[model samples]
Target: MKLPVLVLCLVATAAAAPLALAQTPIDPLDARDVRRLDKMEQVVRELRAIVFQGRDIGKPVVVQPAETDYQLQEVSRRLADLEQTITRMTGDLENANRQAELAKRDAEALRTENRSLSDRIASLESRALAETVAPPGGLGGASSGLSANDLFSEARQALTSGDYAAAESGFREYVDAYGDSSKAAEARYWLGKALTARGAHADAAGSYIAAIRGWPSTSWAPDAVVELSRSLIALKKPADACQTLAEFAKRYPKASTTVKTRAAQARNQAKCAA
Candidate 1:
């Protein structure tokens, strides 16, 4: 049967591909092609002689048909899916960058807030350390921001923490600021203790005496006597030390056992008269 000119033309096009495909066969032939390699090669050569050369050689090559519409549509669908996947990945990358930027800003804000709070705490501590002198103008006054007890406690903490200078400063501030306050006697007593610890026994004696004179009936009174006697001894005033201890019991009739015991020790050491 004679093939139409168009059919023959299609065969000729495939026929021309063999030499080009042989030298550089970029695409791999199909499985069916593997089974017919020799037959396809021989037919291609024959069709090249008859159609493209316009001379009869052997039988012609029966070229395979192009892809059907369904195959082409399936390929288009797969390409579209690949494009959609790439678009989604790009959007996800952008979102991740935005989230990272927001997290960085939040961390920076937290650091700034922490710094501000730390500075405020340091300022409060500095205010607490200022010397307690006055035009009656210190923290012990009612107009003062710090309460008498609060001011006193900070000094006590300094003593507990072994910051003798700060303790002395804080206690003086307490006494000058709130001399009439309930905590005043205790503050003065501790001030003396702080001074004595730092070898300022003369100054310490004055604080103990102030405790004894101003708040004599307070719990610190007998203790003040005990501490005052010690400070006096340190000042090389043994007679005054004996006298202070002698007055301890008469001054604090209901003194604590601790205070009584301490007084007895001081008295014996000073060889005071019973």
Candidate 2:
């Protein structure tokens, strides 16, 4: 009778074992989420099956053995961790999408801005080029066909070919003949460059200063300012050089590389000893 009662108790325990090892359901809408949960569910089912099998192998066994309980708890804890990981991944994907959208918008805005700037620059260049070829509306109208560009090209070619004398002569002629020309400012700037190349620092400083003062809005003004500062330093007038360099940096902060480099050199030379 005692053996039969013990067997009955074991049978009842075995029957209730499967009920104790139940799986938690996961509701996922999207295909990606469905696949992810399917894999997780498979793992959970495997854990449940193993724990239930262990209970059947032992008489009057608990739903999960002590050793099996530890593993099941670990699996549950891992599932919770995976859920948190998925949440974080979803957040990161959302942020990346937002960043990509912002980048696309910013790129479009930059392209529009660049196109506008190019149009403005082209207009200025066209005006400058036209002014270069056109003669002054004065007594010099008869000789209007003679363009400053021709003279400048000749001067530049001569200078580059090491003909300092001819370059100097040509530059002087351009400045005198085209006093009111758009290229006048550039002509004066190049005159200073030519004089400087010929080791005439005093004349170069004068020419550069005149060029910048006469046409502050011209494209050559910034270059003239840089050249003047360098010439002032060479003339041993560091105080004046400092003033010129500081002015150049302040006025043309976004100037050409050559201008910026010269301005830096002038600042170094101008600053006094400690």
**Which is the leading candidate under TM-score?**
1
Clashes of each: 2, 0
Shift of residue 160 alpha carbon in model 2, Å: 2.6
lDDT digits (tens) for residues 1-274 of candidate 1: 3556764775866757667778884777798878797786667566555464333544544656557888989999999999999999999999999999999999999788656644543442243234323222322433467877787887798899998888887788888777887677788889888888999887777777666663367766778789888877777877767756656765677899988998888888777777
Best by lDDT: 1
TM-score computed on alpha carbons, candidate 1:
0.46
The segments of candidate 1 whose C-alpha lies over 4 angstroms from its true place after superposition are 1-145
TM-score of each: 0.46, 0.45
lDDT of 2 at 172: 72
